[model samples]
Target: MISTAWGISFRAFDIGQLRIFFAFGVLQILNLIFISVFTLYQMLSVHTSLTLLALTPIFFMLLTTKIIMPRMAAFTRQNQEAVGLLTNRVTEAFTNIHVIQTNASERSFQRLIAQENDKVYATDMKVLMLRTLFFPLMSALTGLSQLVVLFYGGSLVVQNKISVGDILAFNIYLSYLAFPLTSIGIILSVYQRSKTALERLDPFFNETPESGSDAKILPFPNPNEVDIQDLHFTYPGSIHPVFMGLNLRIRKGEMLGVCGSVGSGKSTLFQILTRIYEPPVGTTYFEGKDVTTLDPITLRREIAYALQKVHLFSASIADNLSFGLIDRPSEEELARASRSAQILKEIESFPDKWDTQIGEKGLRLSGGQKQRLALARLFLRKPKILLLDDVLSAVDNITEARLIQEFRGIGCTMIINSHRGSVLE
Candidate 1:
């Protein structure tokens, strides 16, 4: 993949997207020689010029740069933060475009986006000015060192303390020394940029790690039962709890309808059960075992979740429907699930049908289409338990009724969160 014409996409790309580099770690070992040789050579051959004149200006440059570099780093940090704000605004604007249109709040969004853009422009200017200033300052420091050597070394040669040829050699050596000594500043700058990249990547390190030997092997989780006992949970850094002393039990082949107002923790309950958010120990259990103790991979594979806001990647219809299954779903199976979700007729109407490429997050599909497609994908999995969060909201009454009838035909345990009383019926 690395040698291919397409490397990584720059859009939303970050250090966290270093899968290719980490995979080819051995291939990068050769490049290290260049950095090591240049850096080691400069360190060893630093004092080639013995005179006080040659050494004085170099030391002065070092002292001042140490002070200036910290300021440059601060500017870089602010610039990154400004860029982050711009990114967030762009994401938010696109995601809630429907809401923006419904409320006719384009002007309000325009003003807010303009404000964020101004912040980005101001921070960028600061970084550019500091960077431009750095090069000129470096040039002046190097030039002054050469001037000092001529004035001082020439006088020494004329005084018979040193020969003219000796003074000439000293001048030539100073020129050679200057290149590597000046390079030190460039190296420090590269270091600063790399540090900033690492900072951008820090959040990935905070994610919950995958299970290893320390995790309990749950080879056989009872497909029929899920239980929550006295579950009290809050998000990280949040003082208030979302679920407090919550208890629920779901037995084999039972269909549970969950209905609540907004902010009532319906979706959160599913997230905790699926181990997307770790719950307190002894709080939630699957197959009669604590959910926390179960291997995360096993937990996820056995349970299927479909959220209200469906997400479909930019890919062919068949690919999206078969995304997680160990075996590619056969055409017959695809047709069955799509039919169950009431999307098969629409999908077959496409010129390429299953082969047709859907735009990003199924942009080409209508809201009801996306929801049906997501449901069909989960249906193909035939997971032991289904966690559907308002999946039927977008579809019309007749279509939703048809879907619910087919879904119950599968005979799997299901927990559905829906606001529609018709759905509950």
Candidate 2:
């Protein structure tokens, strides 16, 4: 039966599915036949009524599959979805754990977790109930079937139409039918689960990122400059506009400062400039070419960013610093870049120096150290434009002054987002 189902499901492709399904099905069938044959031989030459009476449990097992399996599959799918939701909630909480704990939100967190747990538990209980109802009902039905077989077969024996041994052989075939029927539900449930899992992941497999027509090889231009005209943007699902009719021009070798209070759309502006979020339809130009016409990867490669929240890989200090460079830098080059960022002394203090692992997100480093390390990485890349989003906030006044003095001679177009007016002065 499983083979037949597989054949129907994959008929358009080939018989490979059928062959695999049939191979397993045949093995199960052989096992059933062996058990039935052994039982029949033991009961042969015995009274026909006695043999029929012993076959009740087998009939009940067959009846259970017909009634039980569909409910179990539905419950399993529900339970999986509940667990997925719970995991998402836990991840979100951990990402904001600092805020939650600071705000004394332990009760709120507990409530949210409890709600998800309750949903999972309810679905789990439903599955248990289904099993409880199925097993006993199957046993009762099998008992009934055996009683009917005994009464009918006994009459046939008395009339001499069939021998007692023949009746026992026939009962053996009935037993074979019972085992397969009982197991059928479990097989179908597995099929349903596998199908659901595939469907859940189908969108990721089917969808590809949109590509522009002008993505072919183009000549690399020197002295990269950017111009934005009437750029407007609103975040997804946001009611208020982030930027409306914003215009700016950034020329080569010029450093620009974008200062604004919290929620003043500073980061949003940077996202627009980088094309991480597309500006409203108009024109954003890069090196005299329209940004919409340029490949996103090419545009980003020319621009280096050091965000307020720096992310580092779990690798050696050298690997993190040299991440954006096309060719691997020599140890001396890495040391020079680190010194230029004023982080070489600190890195050298570590047990392994440049070869030391930073751990996940550079959690092992202090905020100032992480920012400096990120700056080292940006310097290594040597992009045409550098955008530093509040990168100097964590450093002391003297360190901040030293960084600003060094940045002045870096010879790259820079955009600094900072709250410190003294730095701008």
The TM-score values for the models, in the order shown, are 0.85, 0.74
What C-alpha lDDT, on a 0 to 100 scale, does residue 418 get in candidate 2?
86
Query: In model 1, where do residues sit more than 4 Å from their true spots?
Result: 1-50, 97-111, 212-214
lDDT of 2 at 314: 91
True-vs-predicted CA distance for residue 96, candidate 1, Å: 4.0
Worst 10 residues of 1 by lDDT: 1-10
Q: Write model 2 residue lDDT over 124-170, tens digit each, in one string.
A: 78866876676556545655655655677778789986677766665
Give the C-alpha miss distance for residue 63 in model 1, angstroms: 1.2
Q: Rate the local accuracy (lDDT) of all candidates.
A: 0.77, 0.71
Q: Quantify how close model 2 is to the true structure by its C-alpha RMSD in Å.
A: 8.7
Clashing pairs in 1: none
Can you write out model 1's per-residue Cα lDDT over 240-294, one digit (the tens) per residue?
8998899899998999999999999999988888887889989888778888788
